[model samples]
Target: MRHSLRFKVALVFSALTIVLLVAQALGVKTFAEAQEEKLITALIRDDIANVMQGYRANPALLPPFDARLNGYVSAADQPLAALPGSIRNLSEGTHEIVLDDREIHVAVVPFEARRLYRVYNFSVYEKQFRHVIDMLMAGTGIFALLTIWLAYGLSGLLVRQVAGLARQVKALRLGGSTPINPGKYDEVELVGLVEAFNDYHRRMADMIEREKEFTCNVSHELRTPLTTIKTSCELLEQDAAQGTKSRARIQQIERAADNMRELVNALLLLAREESTQNVEPVRLARMIETALAPFADRLANKGVETVIDMDRNVHVAANRSALAIVLSNLADNASRHTDRGHLRFSYADGWLRIEDTGSGISAHALPHVFDRFYQASPEQTAGHGVGIGLAIVKKICDRYGWPVELESEPGRGTRVSLRLPAAGPGSASPDALSAVS
Candidate 1:
C-alpha cells in the first residue's frame, strides 16, 4: 500500500517517454502519407499538361500509355463506356478509386471539346507504404520498451543518493557525536541537507546531556532533605508522651515524605528513555490501598465514597515502583476532582480501571489531558498540580507497554483504564466489593 519515491519517479519518466514517442511516431506517419499523396498528384498533373499541349499543337496525336499511368480522351457529350466502371462516373478534378483491389488516382480535365482523364495506378506504392508503416510501428514499439527500461535505470540512479542518505539517518543513534560525511554526496543540495542534519544531531546530543546532568543534580539535592524529614518523623513518632494530634501530624509528615520520594523516582524514570527496573508480580489490591492512603482524609473531608471492586488475590506482572507511581497519580487526580459521589477502582481481564463521579474534563480539554504541563480552563486550574500527573501515568504506561485510555465528559464524570501486561488467577465477584466511606 505504500509507494516509495523511486517507484514514483520511474513511473513518471516511463509514462512521459511513452507519450512523446507515440506522438512522434504518429506525426511522422501522417506527414509521410501526406507527402506521398502530394508527389503522386504532381506527377499526374504534369502528365496531363504535356498531353494537352501536344494535342493542341497537332489534333491527330494520341495520349500516352504506361504501366502506372494512362490517358483517355472522351467527348464532353459522350458517355465514358470505354473506361473502367469505377472511374466512369467521376466528375472531380482529382479522385482516388479502387479497381479490382488496386488503388488508382484519376485527374479529369476539360479541353476544347473533349474531357481528358489521367488515370494513375499506385497500388504497388500503397502496398510499399503499408509495409513501411508496419515496420515503423514495430520499431516504435521496440523503442518504447527500450525507453521504459532506460527511464527506470535513470530514475534509480537519480534516487540512489537519497536512499543512501535515508539509510544513514536510520542508522544514527541519539547519543552519537559523529556526523554524516558531506563529502560522500555530490550534489550541493544534498550536501547542505547532510550538514543541517549533522548540526541538529549534535544539538540534540548536547541538550540530552544537559538534561541528564540536571535531573541527576536535582535528584540528589531533593532526596537528601526528603530522607532527613522521613527519619526525623520516625524519631518523633517513637516518643512515649506524644499526644494523638501530635502522632497524627508525624504520620502525615511521613506520608508526605513517602509521596515525594515516589514522585522523584517517577520523574527520574520518565526522564530516561529506557527503564532498567526488574519485573515482578505486584499485589493489585495492596498497591491500590497504598496509592489511596494519602488521599483518605481528603476524600473523607469531601464526603466522597470509595469503592474497590476487585478480587483480593489479583496480581499483575510489572515494575512495582512504576505501577505505584501510575496508580498514585490516577488516585490523586480522581480525589482532587471528586467533591461528592463515589470513586471506584476495579480490575477485570488484565485491565485496571479508576472511575470518579466528579467534575469531568470538557470535550476540548479531554484530548490534551495527558500532555505534559497542559492546564485546563481557568476554573479547573485550581489544585490541578500543573497537569503532569496524567502525563507521568501515560509515560509509565508506554514504558511498560501497557495500553492506557481515558474517557471524560463535562458535568458527567471521568474514567481511566490501564491494561496491564499480565494478571494473576482471580475473578471479580459480589464478595469483592469493599466500600469505605
Candidate 2:
C-alpha cells in the first residue's frame, strides 16, 4: 500500500493487456476464418454453378487471371491477384494452374467440347483477414482503456488485505506491542504470518523489561560488599604505614582486595553491556593501556616482561568501559598463567595477539579451554579467582563476529589470537566488546 500508486496501476494494466490482447488476436482470427469458410462453401454450391457448367461444355485452354470461367471473385478495393486473361486459347478438359505461387483448388465440370466450367479458391482466407485486421486495429485502443480501468478496479479490491498488512507492520515498527489486526477470512496464510510477528514482538518486550529489572537489583547488591571491602583495605594500608614491617604483607592483601573489587565492577559492567541500551565508540589500543596500568606490579612480581605494540591512534567501535574490562581480563589471564616467562601483546592486520611463555597447555584440556568454569594448568592457578576469563574472551569474540584461536604445546608456550571477521572495513561493534567481560 505504501508503494507508489503508479506501480499498482501499471501492474494492473499489464495483466489486463495480456488477457485483452490475446482475446482480441484469437477473436479476429476465428471470425476472419469463419467468414472465409462460409464464402468458399457458398461459391462451390450456389453462385458460380451455372458459370462453371457453361465453361465446361466449351473445352479451351485456361488463361492467366481468368475471372469469367474461374469464378475469380474478390472485394471491391483489391480484386484477387489470380490468373489474368480469358480461357479461350488452349484445349482443356480438367486443368491445374498456379496463382501467385499458390495452387488454386479448381474443378472443370464439362458442359461442351469448346467450353469447360472451372472453379478455383486462391487463399480466400488471406483476402478476408485484411478486413478483420483493419477492424481490430481501429478498436484495440478503446478496448485497452476499458481493460485497464476494469483490471485496476478488481486489482485494488484483491490487494486490499495486503494494504492492511502493510499498515500493521508500520504500527509494529513504531509501537512494539501494537496489534496486527488485518482482516483474514480468506487470506489464511498471510494472517498466520502477521500473527506470528506480533507474538514475537510481545515476547521481546517482556524479555527486555525483565532484564532491566534484574540488572538494577544485581548491581545494587554487588556494590555494598565492594564498598565494605575497599574501606577495610584502605584502613589496613594506613595501619601498616604507622610502623609495622608488615607493610609488604598488608600491601599484598590490599592489592588482592582491590583486584576482587575490580572483578565485581567488571561483572556489573558486563551486565550493562548486555542490556545494549547504551553504546559509544572506543579505541582498543587505549583500553589496552588502561588495563595494563593496574597489572604493572603483577608483571614485576613474576619477572615476566610485557610488550605493547600497536598503532597509536587505532580505533574500534565499542563502549570504553566495556572494552577496558575485556582487555583487563585478557591481560590478567596471560600474566597469571605465565610463571616467569615473557608476555607479548601486539595488534597487527586488524587483530590482537597475546602469547605467554609458561607451561604450555595440556593436550586433554585444550578442547575445553574456554568453557565457563575451566581452570588453567597448575602453574597459572596460584589464585585464579574464577574460571570465567577465557569464557568471557570467547563470548566477546562471538559478539563482535571475531574469531579467537589458541595454540599451545606441552612445553613450548601458549598463544591466543583475536582476529577481525569479514565485516565491511570497520572496527569492532559495541555488543562484541561488551561480551568480553
Candidate 3:
C-alpha cells in the first residue's frame, strides 16, 4: 500500500506535534517538582533556625506545632531506640522517608546538649501535585487530537492544486486543441509544469496533422496507379484473343493491386487516432471465407488444409473495411508460414481464434513477431513477407478496442485470439444470411 503525499505530510506534522507536547509537559512537571522541593527546604531551614534561637534564649519554650510540621528535641546522648523507629538513626541533615505510609521530610540538628528533629508531612502536597499531573496529561491528549486534525486539513489544502492538475491531465484527450490553463494555478512550479505539458500537446497535435496530410497525399497518389493497373487487367481479361496464361498473369497482377489497396487503407486508418462511425453487423463465417480466398491456391499447393469453425448466425459490429484488413492479414500470415499442416479459424466465447500447425516461432523471435518489419530469421523470410502483416493486424485491433493475443512455441505452431465487438439488435440481413448459408 502506498500513502498519498497529503497523508504522509499530515502524519509527519502530527508526530512532531506529539513529540513537542510530550517534551513540554515533562519540562513543566520537572520544573514544578524542583521548585516545590526548594520551597520545602527553605521553610524547614527557617523553622530550625528559629527553634534553636528560641530554645537558647529560654530553655522552657517549646517548638511551634501544626498539622503539617512537628518539632522534637531530646538529649544529645539519648539512645537511638528512644526516638521514633522511622527516624531513629537520622544524622544532622534533612531526609525524606515513608513513615506510616505517608511521605515525611525530617531535619535533624545538634545543639550543645540537645538534638532537634523537624518532621514535615508532604503527602497532602504530593496529592495536589498528582492532580496537576493528571490535568497536564488530559491537556496533552486533547491538544494532540486537535493538532492531528489541523495537520490533516492543512495537508489537504497544500495538495489541492496538485490533485486538480492530475484530474485535468487525466481528462485530456489526444489531438484536443485545448491546453491546460496555467493561469488557474498560483504556484510557480505548477504553472511551469502546466506550460510544459501544453507545449508537448501542441507539438503532438502538429505531428498528427502532418501525418494526416502525408497519408492523404500518399493515398491519392498511390491509388491512382493501382486503379489504372486494375482497370487494365480487367480490360485484358475481357479480350477474347488473350491467351489463357496471359489472362492468368493479369489476374495475379489484379489481386496484387487489390491487396496493396487494402494495405494502404489499413495504414491510413491506423495513422488516424479516431474511431470509425461506419460500423454495421457483419456475418463472421462469410467474412472469414472472403479473407482466406486469396490464400486458397497457396494453401492447396502446400497441402495445408484451411478450416473455419464459426456459426453462420454469429455476427459482429465493426467497420467493414478495417475488419476485412485485419482478417486478411491474419489469414495471409498463417497461410505463408504453414507448409503442410492445417490452419484453423474458430469463434467462441467472444473470441475469434486462428491456429496454425506450421513451422512454429522460436521463443526469442515470438515476442518481436508483431513488431513492424521484424523478420524472425533469414530462412523464414523467403515466403514470409517483410513482417508487417501481424503488426498491421495489431494496429487495426487496437484501433477498434479489440484485444488480440498471440501464443507460440518452437516446433509446436502458433495461435492468435481476437476479441470482437458484439453486434447490435436486428443487425442480421436476411438475403446475406441465406447467401452465405
Candidate 4:
C-alpha cells in the first residue's frame, strides 16, 4: 500500500515491455501460418495439373505413387467409389482432408475420359509451425527478463538522485551546510525546490538580524530618558511636603522608573545574547516587592487584592536585572487581568506560581499562550496588550533552560508557574544584599 516512486515506475515500464513483446509474438505466429498456407496451396495445384495431364496422355498408364504424392485409380466397374467424401463432388480446386492422424491436401482433377485425385501430406508443415512457436516463446521470455532488469536499473538511478536531494535538505535544516547546487539535478521541480529553500533561509536570517539590531538600538536610546525620569522622581520624593500623600505617590513613581530601567537592561542583554549568570542571592520577599512596585498603584486603583506567600530567607542564584524583568512581566500580566479577586504570588518546592482571578484563556487558545502575538480572544485582549508579555517570559526562560507552565479555565482564572534550580555553592546569602523594604 505504501509503494515508493521507483517501484511504481519500474512496474509500469516492465508492463509496457511485456505488452509489446506479446504483440510481437502474436504477429510472428500469424504471418508464419499465412505464408505456410500459401506455399501448400501452390504445391497442391501444380501437382494436380501434372497428374491430370499425364493420365490423359496414357489412359492405360497410371502415374507413379510416392510418399510425398499419393493417388488412387478406380476400375471401370467401381469408378472412384472408395474415394473420400471430401472429394466426392469432383471439384477442380485444392481441398484438405484428414486420414487417421495425418492431414492431407487433396487436388481433384476431372478429365474427359478419367478422374484423378492428387494428395499431398501436410503433417510436416504442422510440425515446423509448432517448432517456430516454441522458439518465439523462448525469445519472448528472454526479452521480458531483460526488460525487467533495465527498468529496475533506471528506476534505481532516479530514486538515488531524489534521496540525495533529501539528504541535502536535511543538512540545511540542521544548520550543517550552505545551499546545495540545484544545477546538478536534471529535474526541473527538484531544482526549483532547492532554489526555493535556499532563498527562504537567506530571507529568514536577514530578518532576524535586522530585528536584533532594532531591539538593541531602541533599548539603548530609551535608557537616557528613563534615567532622567528616575532622577526627577527621586528629587520630587525628597523635597515634597511631609504630611502629603503626594510624597508616597512620588516614591511610587521612582520605583516604577527603577523597574523600567531594569527591563531595558535586560532587553539589551537579550539582544546581545549575553549569559545572565552573574549569580546573586537576593531575598525572595524583597525581590517580589520590587517587581510588584510598579503595579501597586494599578492594583489599588482596580481594587484588586495582593497576596504574597514567600519566605524572607529564601534566596536564589540569579542576575538581578534579568530576574526583575521576568518577575515584573509576570506580575504585571496578573494585575492587568484580575479586577476584583486577589492576585496571588506563592513560592514553594522551588516553584513560583502567579495566579489571577480573571477571564481565563479558552481551551483553543491555551496551548498557544506563549506564542508571539497570540491572543486568547480578540474581545478580551482588544484594549489590554499586543500579547507579547508571556512570549517574552517564555523566551527568557528558554534561553536559561528554565521550565515554565500555564493552566487556565474559561471564566475561572489563570495560573503560571516557573521552576527554578535549587540553591548551591554558586549562590550568595540574603544578608549580603540590602533588602528592598
My TM-score estimates for the predictions, one after another, are: 0.81, 0.58, 0.75, 0.51
Encode model 2's per-residue lDDT on 306-414: one tens digit a residue: 8777765556555344455567887887777677879887877867888889777888999998899888554458566568878877776565455788999877788
lDDT-wise, the better of 1 and 4 is 1
Per model, state how many residue pairs clash. Answer: 0, 22, 0, 0
For residues 242-328, could you state the per-residue lDDT of candidate 4 as single tens digits?
A: 447887777777777787788887777676777665566666677888888888888999998888888766777666777788898
Which residue pairs clash in candidate 1?
Answer: none
Q: Which scores greater on lDDT, model 3 or model 4?
A: 3
Against the correct fold, how does model 2 do in TM-score?
Answer: 0.58
lDDT of each: 0.81, 0.65, 0.81, 0.77
Better of 1 and 3 by TM-score: 1
Model 1: worst 10 consecutive residues (lDDT sum): 428-437
Candidate order, TM-score descending: 1, 3, 2, 4
In lDDT terms, how accurate is model 3? 0.81
TM-score of 1: 0.81
Write the residue-wise lDDT of candidate 1 on 100-214 in tens digits.
5666666887765455676566777789998999899899899999988988899899989999998888778633456889999999999999999999988988898899999
lDDT of 4: 0.77
Q: Which pairs clash inside model 3?
A: none
Q: How displaced is residue 328 in candidate 1, in Å?
A: 2.0
Alpha carbon lDDT at 53, candidate 3 = 89
List runs of model 1 lying over 4 Å from the truth. Answer: 53-89, 99-102, 111-114, 174-176, 239-243, 275-279, 371-377, 380-384, 398-401, 423-437
